[model samples]
Target: MDENKSYLYDFIKGLWKENPVLVQLLGMCPTLAVTNAVENAIAMSVAVVFVLTASAIIISLIRKLIPAQVRIASYIVVIATFVTMADRYLAAFYPAQSKALGPFIPLIVVNCIILGRMEAFASKNGVFRSILDALGMSFGFAIALLLMSSFREILGNGTWLNMRVLGSWWDNWMVMILPPGAFLTLGTIVGVSRFIQTKLKKA
Candidate 1:
């Protein structure tokens, strides 16, 4: 029972309490860059989920074999391997998303969220726990991306996933799909998240 609770706690915390994007503020690059549209956000989120979870599993399994001196480098190599697979698969089958994502997909190798988990949780824990942690963080990352994308896409383009959400009367806010819009959305999300967390604590 204690073990189950421990696993549950680890998994649940990342969903909201320690969300990588909203609360922890990690992986800001993709969070702000690719979130101009819902499709882009989904592709980035899926890629991150695969990369973070797979990388964590491998790192946890081989933690004992990796020397501390070159551990960081080893982690990057493993991360890059999975990232390459994801990139190629997307390019071959999901060319549109791949093209839209461009260098961002290949850049997952350096995502601090993935590397941070490998170094902090995976290296110190067993495979099962590491997987759970990776999943939790992945979901948290996805949620933030979805939230950001939903807002940007709907308000900016007056559509969600290229499907119209607002009527003709609604004027699309062009700024919402631009770089400055990403900053505004991120700041708003972070601020709202902080306020909610504070309220929850008080309650």
Candidate 2:
């Protein structure tokens, strides 16, 4: 029962309480860069989920074998390998999303979120625990990306996933599609999230 509780807590925490982007502020690059559209956000999230989970599993399995002095380098190599696989797979099959994402796919190798997990959670934990943590973090990332993308798409383009949701009367907020808009939108989200969290704690 205690073990199950532990796993559940670890998994649930990342969903909101400790979200990588909104909470922990990790992986801001992709969060702001690729979130101009819903499709791009989802694509980035999927790649991150795969890379983070796979790398966490691999790192957890081999943690004992890795020397402390060179563990960071080892982790990067493992992360880079999976990133390459994801990049090529996307480029081959989902070429449009692959093109949209472009260098950001390769940039995952250096994404602090993945590396932070390997160093902080996976390195010292058992494989099962690491996997749970990775899943939670990945979901957290996905949720944030989805929320950001949805908001940006609706306001900026007056569409969701390329389908017009708002009527023709609605004038799109051109700023929502720009770089400044990403920052503004994310800032608003983070602020509201914190406010809600504070209220929940009081309640």
Candidate 3:
């Protein structure tokens, strides 16, 4: 494939085929912690996309100069800088969400998904390719979070994106909003995803 086509493929692959959440299972902390609602899921995903894309571009540009011994540290610094910006932006414009997301924003500094991309892909690719890879991975992460949150929000709260989906007859499953709920929902989703993958492979 041509360079342009390859870059596009990498970007799109992150959204589904090799999604950071479903496929690689990176950054589970924020994936489970902040995804209680669709809005929070979107916010977290957007923050990740911003930080990952920025760090990937910077890391790709300086990949040759960053010595292997300190490369991880450098990537963390780059990612932290972007995460700080995202945190500040959310705090200023979306205080409620910022409060709800809380420490997860700063916790992005330690998210394996960001660092993994920087070390495994961005550091080895050109600027454009790195950006595309980050975009794809971020999209994948977002989709997984959205799906999980949607399930939890709908069942646990009888709402989807804060809108009532079920009538009063439906008793909310409070477990879905708690930490255990996060695990159960994520576990089920992961199992289903694996099952589908297995069937596809057999076919």
Candidate 4:
């Protein structure tokens, strides 16, 4: 394949086929923890995009110099630096969302999805390719979280993005807003994704 085309392929693949959340099952902690609302999901997605893209760029630029034995630690450090910046930015400008997200912003430092991409893809790829991969992975993560959170928020609160979507007669399912709701929603989504994949393969 042509070099440019290969880069596009790597970037596009993460959005669906090799999605970090649906396919690779990475970074589940924040994926399930902070997605109780659409706003929170969007915030988390932005943070992940900033951290992942920055880490990928840095790691790709220094791929040749980093020793394999210490690459993971180096990647974590790079990811942490970006996460800290993102956390501070949120706290400074969006205090309410920052307070709502709580420790998850700082916890982005340890998100395996970012680190995994740095080690498995960015650390061996060219800078442009790494950026593309990061974009795709971040988009994939965002989409997955948005979908999960949308379902939970809508069903549990009778609202979608804070817009009333249900009738006055509707009784909201309180369970969908609790911790168990996150697990149930994620579990059901995972199962459905697998089912779709299986059907596609069989077809």
Q: Which stretches of candidate 4 lie over 4 Å from their true place?
A: 1-5
TM-scores, in order shown?
A: 0.97, 0.97, 0.96, 0.95
Q: Which ten residues in a row have the lowest lDDT in candidate 3?
A: 1-10
Q: 146, model 4: CA deviation in Å?
A: 0.4
TM-score of 2: 0.97
| Angstrom error at residue 72, model 1 | 0.3
lDDT accuracy of residue 2 in candidate 4: 77
TM-score of model 1 vs. true structure: 0.97
State each candidate's clash count. 0, 0, 0, 0
List the global CA lDDT of all models.
Answer: 0.94, 0.95, 0.92, 0.90
Order by lDDT, highest first: 2, 1, 3, 4
Alpha-carbon shift of residue 137 in model 3 (angstroms): 0.2
**Mind giving the per-residue lDDT tens digits that candidate 2 earns over 14-60?**
89988999999999999999999999999999999999999999999
The digit string of per-residue lDDT tens for model 3 on 1-203 reads: 47446757889988867878888889999998997898899999999989999999999999999999999899988998999999999999999999999999999999999999998999999999899899989889999999999999999999998999999999999999999999999999988998898899999
How well does candidate 4 match the true structure, expressed as C-alpha RMSD?
1.8
* lDDT per residue (tens digit) for residues 62-106 in model 4: 999989899888888888889989999999999989998999999
Which residue pairs show collisions in model 4? none
lDDT for position 11 in model 2: 88
Per-residue accuracy of model 1 over 1-203 as CA lDDT, tens digit each? 57545989779878998899998899999898999999999999999999999999999999999999999999999999999999999999999999999899989998889998999899999999999999999999999999999999999999999999899999989999999999999999999999999999999
lDDT winner, 2 or 4: 2
Residue 152 of model 3 has an lDDT of 95
